[model samples]
Target: MEHVTDTPTVKAPAERFTGDVFLHPIATPAEPARLAAALVRFTPGARTHWHSHALGQVLHITDGVGLVGTRDGNVVRVRAGETVKCPAGEEHWHGATDATLMAHLAMVVGDGSGDGTSWLEPVTDEQYAAALAGPGR
Candidate 1:
């Protein structure tokens, strides 16, 4: 049994996030362990850049509401207790809504090469607005 008190909470890099975001690492096992977990919090309107995982990712919403969008313009509104699965290599972005703070547990399965996610451009405001105005749950 290992107690984790060393990994510090980090501000999500600006290059990869828009607005204010925080990441609280939960687990990152040693070699041969490919699973990693973190609690990511997004302030109102904060969001990640488009990105994809080498394997896949699972997000379990823990607080407030947010939106998850795919390249195909499918945006999903996720609330507390909801879960979202992003398949490997699927380009996507997720963030808090314009009026709400959001938090979620992000569980990622890596491809054993250490870095598992490829981050792309920040989501545009127009895109975000469309998500809010578009029809989706």
Candidate 2:
């Protein structure tokens, strides 16, 4: 068994998110034997841009409420203690709701050949607003 050393926390990129957000990388691609995990904190209305994983991604909600949206027009409201599985290459976006702060442990599974994630463009305000408007609005 190998013990990992403590690592410093890092601020999430402003370009990748909105509002106050932070990320703590628990593992990385370099450690393929281990799953890549990130502690993600989102301020009210903060969220990630639409993206996908080459392998897939799992999210376990730690606190508050989160919203996960898909290109097929599915928006799921996930709360603390809930686990969400996003299938490989499924275009999706996730973030905190407008009224709450949210945090989740995001796990990105490594592809045997590397190239585990593929990040797309940021979610446009128009898309977000439309999502907030609810279905058939």
Candidate 3:
């Protein structure tokens, strides 16, 4: 058994995120381990840029409300205790709602080539609004 000490939380880079976001890395890909995990926190209206993983991702909400949007213009509202699975190579973005602070644990696998994610572009304001207004929950 390994007792991991608490690590410092890092602010997400402005180039990759909008508003204020933070991350605490839990585990990272290393020799003989292809798994990566992080505890991500987003302030209201904060979010990541559009990106996709080569080996998929799993998000487990820990607090407050969050939104996940896809390139298809679909948006999903996830709350505490909800788990969301994003298929590999499907571009998506996730963030906190306008009125809520959100936190989640992100788990992902590496593709064995040290490549895990491909970042596309920042999500446009129009796209975000449209996603919020999209049909279905």
- The most accurate candidate by lDDT is 1
When 1 and 2 are scored with lDDT, the better candidate is 1
**Model 1, span 1-137: residue lDDT tens:** 77767888899999999999999999774577788899999999999999999988999999999999999999999999999999999999999999999999998987777649998999999998999887753
User: What are the C-alpha RMSDs, in order, of all predicted structures?
Assistant: 1.3, 2.5, 1.5
Which structure is stronger by lDDT: 1 or 3? Answer: 1
RMSD of 3: 1.5
- lDDT of each residue in 1-137, candidate 3, tens digit only: 66889789999998889899999999888868898999999999899999999989999999998899988877899999999999999999999887889999999998887648888889888877776666643
* TM-score, model 3 to reference: 0.93
Looking at candidate 3, the ten consecutive residues that score lowest on lDDT are 128-137
Quote each prediction's TM-score: 0.95, 0.87, 0.93
lDDT of 3: 0.89
What is the lDDT, from 0 to 100, of the residue 67 in candidate 1? 97
Compose the digit string of candidate 2's lDDT tens values, residues 54-124. 88899999999878899988988889999999999999999988888999999987886554777788888
Rank ordering of all candidates by TM-score, starting from the highest: 1, 3, 2
Ten-residue segment with the worst summed lDDT in candidate 2? Answer: 128-137
Cα displacement (angstroms), candidate 3, residue 111, comes to: 1.4
**lDDT of all predictions, in order shown?**
0.92, 0.83, 0.89
Error at 18, model 2, angstroms = 2.9
Higher-TM-score candidate among 2 and 3?
Answer: 3
